[model samples]
Target chain A: MSETVLYDYWRSSASYRVRIALNLIGESYRSVPVDLLARAHRAPEHLGRNPQGLVPVLDIDGERFTQSLAIIEYLAETRPESGLLPGVAVGRQRVRALSHAIAMDIHPVCNLGVVAHVTAVAENGEAARRAWMQKFIGEGLAAFERMLDHPATGAFCHGEAPTMADICLVPQVYNARRWEVDLSACPRIVAIEARCAAIDAFARAHPDRSK
Target chain B: MSETVLYDYWRSSASYRVRIALNLIGESYRSVPVDLLARAHRAPEHLGRNPQGLVPVLDIDGERFTQSLAIIEYLAETRPESGLLPGVAVGRQRVRALSHAIAMDIHPVCNLGVVAHVTAVAENGEAARRAWMQKFIGEGLAAFERMLDHPATGAFCHGEAPTMADICLVPQVYNARRWEVDLSACPRIVAIEARCAAIDAFARAHPDRSK
Candidate 1:
């Protein structure tokens, strides 16, 4: 079989999600860092890998895949036993919904490019950027916490397994801490984060470890 | 079967995407408009449906579902003949990558609440809002157009069929036209939008028609 390659940035929430998924499935792969800080993602070579010029593009089974969640979905589908997602439609629906709440509702708003532009146009750039991150990350995580108040949510985001929802939540929580977003009201999220932190797959994929 | 109720805002891109999917599946659904302008989504009634307080919370098959894409996935999975997502992993990957390019990267960055906050913090609020929409939407679609330059793309986003990618594209194009984002360079996207516009499902789901 051909080798798997992951184009990623160590700290990107999207990239981190993929890293954890790969680890969960015990898929050993090469990590090619596309440094966002250096604008490496926008370069032509990187753009060739993904027109969207995003991180965490995976090349496996002789095909390249973009979008962290999509790539994760691809992996989950190919290796259902890995259980990145649930087997049944109802379980899948819940997992995907919880995942999107973070990946879509939270991560994108606090995306580096979007926040950079907002701060650039504001009077106090750095402070505006910090405020932007804290507000969105804090609010997004809090909503995610409320989302966890379901019978379906057990030790992880769904059932007792660490599905895609848990993979997504860990990175957002990481970002929340990075930006000092208050987690006082997000007890469920904090507990899930703590559980995920104990898992080897998640710990190996942490930004600190990867860096 | 239980009646399907869609808690939606007529103008929300996310809501509009679900509307298109329901129309495509020929599913009859009751539209309960959650007025974002009046902050109806933030009310307790809506929150009870979806803690995220987002529109397009679907009550279908006696279960409540949040997140437009996840609901669409459930619809697709339960009705595989509908072909909202492709059957194969590779096809699903491409379709999902295309979908996320718009749904995750573009739509969320231009979310109403995020824009409202960004604009409020800027000096010239209205102008900043316009520029923000144009910049993100314009760049996002341009990249999407580039993504379309692949063998998988056909009359629709993936193959000749309208999958989740097209479901996502239609609403984003609606927003682009609403915000008057320049579309000259996005010929593939423009052409796809035109094709999707010709379909009955897409036409009926149009915000103008729905409103």
Candidate 2:
């Protein structure tokens, strides 16, 4: 069989999300690190794998894929028993919404490239990066906490098992802690993060472990 | 059947994406304007519809949904013939990757709130906003144009039909023109936008017409 390979940056929230997904599926894949800090993602080699020059590009089933959430969806579609997403349409929608609440709303705003641009453009440089991270990560998680108040949210973001929502959540929580964003207002999120942290799949996918 | 309603700000790129989806699905929905400029989205009532307090909160099939891409996924799943996504897994992944290239990568960074914050922090206010818009939108669409270079890209973003990718592409092109981003570098994207603009469903969903 052709091997599954994941090209990822250890600290990228998007890459972290897909790492958890591959672990959950128990898919043994080779991990090729693309260091974002060194601007390695923009190199011709990595850009060839992804025109966007983003990480967590999985070369699987003999085809290369980009976009972490889309990669998760592809994995879920092919490996339904992995439960990366739920079965029913509404459940899947809820999962997708919860995932996007982080992937689209929070993670993108805190992206390394975006933060670098913000820091460069603003007067304070380092201070601007810190403040940018805190404001967006703090506010985005607060809204996510409210979204979790729904009855569908259980030990994980969706139900008893860790679905795509939890996969997206763990990495964002990692970012929050990295930025020292307050988690006091997010009891549900904190609890959910704690639950996901205990899982082998999620635990193995941690940035610290990956590094 | 219960009436379907879409709570959206006419000028929101995210809202515009959903408007195109609903129009494409041939699903008639009551358009409830939640004006972002007036801060209607953050109001208590709108928050009740979506705790995220974002526009393009879709109420359909008796379930209220948030996150524009997720709502489009729901529509595509329920109405497979709509072809918001492709039928095959690989094709679906391609469509989603294209959709998210804009939705997750570009749109969020240039989001009204994000840009407002950027304008506030940078030395120059309006100039910062304009520069921020032009840089991110221009670069993003350029990368998107590169993505469209694949063999899968036909008349539209993915194939002969307009999928979710096209729904995402049109609003972004509107923003590109609104920001006066140089599209001379993106002939393929420009051509695709022209095709989407001609379709009645896409035409009616334009922020101008919605207003």
Candidate 3:
């Protein structure tokens, strides 16, 4: 098998999301940690590979790619049997929509860089940043629960097996817990996270284990 | 052909993206105006169709979907000849990453709701919001310019033909121009947008025309 390499940071929900995907694909790769706090992502080498300055850029068969969802979609396409995305158009739409709720709506709004900017502008302190994260995280997940109410949602965000939606959901849930966002209203999301937790792919990809 | 309906807010970059895609596909859809100012997106009907409370919910042949990129991907898959995304895996990844640079990084951060939240906390008024948008938009476009510098970039975002990346790029450029963000640094993106502007597909999807 050809070697795959992942540029990662331990706690980034985006990076964590990609790790889960790699694990699910059963692809073993060397993980080169990008120390985000150390401002390593801003370095020239990293910028050359990914102008977005985001972590979880993957190199598979010498082809480099960035964006967690994009990388995962690439995997799903090249390695179709991974089931990263469901097969049918409607099913794929549902999974992608669910993934965006957290990835685009929730995660990006409260990204560490964004939050830092918010703090600098507002100067409202850590409590304010936490509150900001909590509010959006709560609302985003509540909406996610509504999306999951569909009959298609099973043990995962899509069906019986984990898809890209589940891969994204677990990490956002991880962020929610880290920021102490209350998940009382998102029973469906919590249940899916529980199911994902039992899977070795998800279990071994935990941020704690990534360390 | 199935009748397709797009629930849209004219000025929204996301809605604009779908409009361009629909135009590119040569598919006509009824556009239902969802007044973001009136908070119509929070209405029960809209929420039921799109739990995320965002615009550009597409209904075609009774199948409903959300997220502009996902909907575009579906259209690209179902309408293979439209060339919304490229045929090759590497090509698709490049297009998606470019789309996400604006969709996930710049757009979400400056969304109306997010900006409103910024005003509420920062209390710095419109100037602050515009500055905030400028900071991210400028940096994002600068990054996008670097992404465009690749050999893949052509008359549009990818090759000579317009793909999903151009569909996304046009609207982001629209937003950037509207927000008065300087495009001087992003020569490549500006050139692409100018080329896209001349195309009837993009012109018809203009927010002004949507009105």
Superposition TM-score, candidate 3 onto the true structure = 0.98
lDDT of 1 at B186: 87
Off by over 4 Å in 1: none
DockQ of each: 0.91, 0.90, 0.78
Q: Which regions of candidate 3 are displaced past 4 Å?
A: none
lDDT of 3: 0.89
Compare candidates 1 and 3 on lDDT and give the better one: 1
Q: Per-residue lDDT of B106-169 in model 2, one digit per residue for the tens? A: 9999999999999989998899899999999998999999999999999999999999999999
In terms of docking quality, model 3 is medium
True contacts kept of 3: 0.71
Q: What is the C-alpha lDDT profile of model 3 across A6-96, one tens digit per residue?
A: 8999998888988999899999989999999999999999998788778988989678899888888999998899999999988998888
TM-score order of candidates, best first? 2, 1, 3
Q: True contacts preserved, each candidate?
A: 0.87, 0.85, 0.71
Tens-digit lDDT track of model 2 for A1-211? 7899989988988889899999999999999999988999999999888999889899999899999999999999999999999999999999999999999999999988888889988999899999999999999999999999999988888989999999999999999999999999999999989988889999999999998
* Residues forming the 10-long window of minimal summed lDDT in candidate 2 chain B: B1-10
Q: Which scores better on DockQ, 1 or 3?
A: 1
